[model samples]
Target: MAEQNKHLYYIDELSDYKISDGYPDVRGWDVKDIDNRVIGKVDNLLVNKEAERVVYLDVEVDKSIIDAKYDPYGRPVQTEVREFVNKDGENHIIIPIGLVDLNEDSNYVYTDIIDHRTFSETKRYRKGGNINRAYENQVLGSYQRRRTGSADSRDLDVFKDEIRLREIIREEIRRYHHDIDKDVTYGTLETHDASRPRVDDDVLIEDEIELSQRRSNDEVYDDDNFYKRREFDDKRFKKRTPGL
Candidate 1:
């Protein structure tokens, strides 16, 4: 007697997946064997737009038991298959939509139907596909590793040189301002007081006093000449002398 296979419905058949509503929640799914042996948990859903339903699932199986041959959506690609086998040492498998049954409350799929040959064939196809293209699709290609060592040192040196030159220029500017401040203070003391004698007037008085002292110290004078006596005894001499 042939064994009776269990019937499964597509995602669109569910009442919540009608035209007015959004996608059905398939978070509750468990990968199992024909005897209902639990394999893995359903990690994601793969929706098919043409069919208006979910056609595949992303099952997280044990890495020791199976290799990852396809993307999370079950699309087969080469680089993933190569890495999965060489690094993980397991084969990738596929579970068809028809074989799975959804459990709404548990948010899981339970199924006893699985196509082993089809799953193996899909893995072979992915292995034969272009690895470079597969890697490009799964990874962000634009990001690069940070440069280090010699290249980083060169950049730091350039920055330090710029900072040193800026500091030198700032010091020269500060010294120029300081010299201007000292000259302004000296000029203010010499010119701002009207009661105090002017610098030029004080200099002239000092010169006249020295000349009178020099003439008084000289003894070569005509004692008999009244004009000579008047010249020596004039009011100008009294003004020039310190006691007068």
Candidate 2:
């Protein structure tokens, strides 16, 4: 990213995405490996404004697991035990979304290819520091290496121009926002102009139009958002169906 665009924010921080994708809100879910070993709990997600997709998942590693060495690379040789501690979110790992498996069953995300050792070995996100494209590539490449289920193989290499990547992202985001602005400016007017207002027919109007527009707005858009669905995990909200 450019010097001006080095700032990284959580997905919830972006206004347009919240209005569009309805806040993924997958934070607080557990992150695990394919075998169901607890890796971390999701702290947050990183959004690439240019790409309009989640790029990285900010995960807080479990201290007990990080403290013990585990082979994330799937090596037959057991990893030698080492001591590492989670101090001030230092143990957090920013794994790319490409490697993630969003498991709705247990509501835990999984990365089938990596483990504690990989996260501990790789260069991680430092608070208050800019993540240059080169650093980001290393992180992505690190995960990619293990994705093939191989501890030893050579199939992942792409020479990327960080500066060029920055320019491309900026250009993409600019065009995306331009189209959005154009639509916002004319969408209502276009709809109104298409249909003529008929005075003879009485308008039986309700606030359903505004409510329907909010279908993808926020937590309210959720089918049983304010109320709980039958499969709800908590008791704070009412059931979607009326109680007996």
Candidate 2 to native Cα RMSD, angstroms: 20.5
> Each prediction's Cα RMSD?
46.8, 20.5
Candidate 1 local lDDT, 1-244, one digit each (tens) = 1112111223333555532232345444566544455656655443333344444444555442344333332233555464323233223233434445554455555553332222322332122122122222121111011121322453345445546845664455445544644332323454444554433334435554444334323132212331221112222111123352
Which residue pairs clash within candidate 2? none
lDDT of all predictions: 0.36, 0.50
TM-score of each: 0.29, 0.48
lDDT of 2 by residue, 1-244 (tens): 4545353467666676652332245689888875668877888777655445556678777776556644333222434532222334455667665556565546777765666556655554443244444445455545544434532222222222333544565555445544644433322444333244421112212223233333324333223231121111222111223353
Against the true structure, candidate 1 reaches a TM-score of 0.29
Best by TM-score: 2
Which parts of model 2 are misplaced by more than 4 Å?
1-3, 19-24, 69-89, 127-129, 150-244
**Candidate 1: regions farther than 4 A off:** 1-24, 67-94, 103-107, 115-244
